[model samples]
Target: MGTYLITGIGRGIGQELTRILLSRGDRVIGTVRDPGQVPAEWEAFVKNGRLELLKLDVRDEASIADAASRVNEPVDVLINNAGIIGPDRQSTLNMDFEGFLDTLRVNTLGPLRVVQAFLPQLRRSPQAKIVTISSRMGSLSYAKSDRIAYRASKAAVNKVMQGLATDLAVDGIAAIAVHPGWVQTDMGGSGADISVQQSAAGLVKLVDRLTLKETGGFFDWQGDAIPF
Candidate 1:
């Protein structure tokens, strides 16, 4: 089984992805901002030898570097799933600048820092896959509506993933940007259309099918390329 590293494992899609990966015999290295936040049920998985949890604050670059150093084994896959959405949900004019910057720190810069810090481990892998969880709302083509901070941050991440895909191509690693769909989670809210399991499963399938040809393209849960 492949070695997988995932962030934001405290809850939602990240937690479900960790569970599914472990069930399929893949080793999971998950990061949670607070170690205490790890669910008790998940502890059994850690105890049984399939999963590992680390305290990681994605907003902190030093923390990212420290965590990256702990992965002694090669990482076949790195899923940048950690992100945040503030509760205000305001329009750009009414949005809080501090809050907007906070979202950008977690959603955009966090993945870039992690990918940079962990490049060594990823380079050592036989088939390296860097999967950044982007969003349709991030699509500049679809930005007739307003989400202000989230939209801008995710859109920036999409570009980051695209550039990385091109730069890392010679190493045979595939860097993919994917929208997980409107998943029912804390961030997606109760009205979202898809369950976390459905989104996670589809994402795993998409990652499995990733090739250098598909790298740098933004995609949805069904693997359809999303317009920039």
Candidate 2:
């Protein structure tokens, strides 16, 4: 089975992703802002050896480096799932610039830093992939309204994934952006249409089916490509 690293594994989509990966017999190294933050279920996963929890905060470079060093095996996949929504959704004219910056720091730059820090280990893997947990809100072509911060950061990440795909191709590593859909998570809210289980299952299927040819494209949970 493959070895994977996932950020923001304490709760919500990240936690669900970890559970699915472990159930599939893949080894997962999951990151949390604090180890104490992991729920009882996650702690069980950690104790069982299917999952390893590293204390990490995507906003902190040192934490990212420390977490990367904990993995002794080469990572087959890296999931940049850690992200945040700003204060509240609003029109561009009413959005706060500082909130937007915070969103970019976690959702955009955090993934970039993780890739940079873990490139060596990823290169050691025969078939490595980088999956950024982006959003449909990121698609400029499809975005008819404004989320301001969330949309901007995700869009930036989509572009960043493309650039990484180009540079990592020579080493046989693929990078792609994925939209997990609006699931019932803290970020997604209770009114969201999809459940976390369904979203995670679809995402895992997409991940297992990813090919080098698909790198740099934005995809949905159903494995269809989304235009930039």
Of the candidates shown, which would achieve the greatest lDDT relative to the real structure?
A: 1
Candidate 1 per-residue lDDT over residues 1-228, each given as its tens digit: 888899998899898888888888888999999988877887787898678887899899999989988888788999999998743764766877788888899999999999998899999998899999989988988745577788889999999999999999999999988999999998899999999999999998898888888989999988999897
Which ranges in model 2 have alpha carbons more than 4 Å from their true place? none
In candidate 2, residue 210 scores what lDDT?
92
TM-score per model over all chains: 0.96, 0.95
lDDT of every model, 2 decimals = 0.89, 0.88
> How does model 2 score by TM-score?
0.95
The weakest ten consecutive residues by lDDT in model 1 span: 84-93
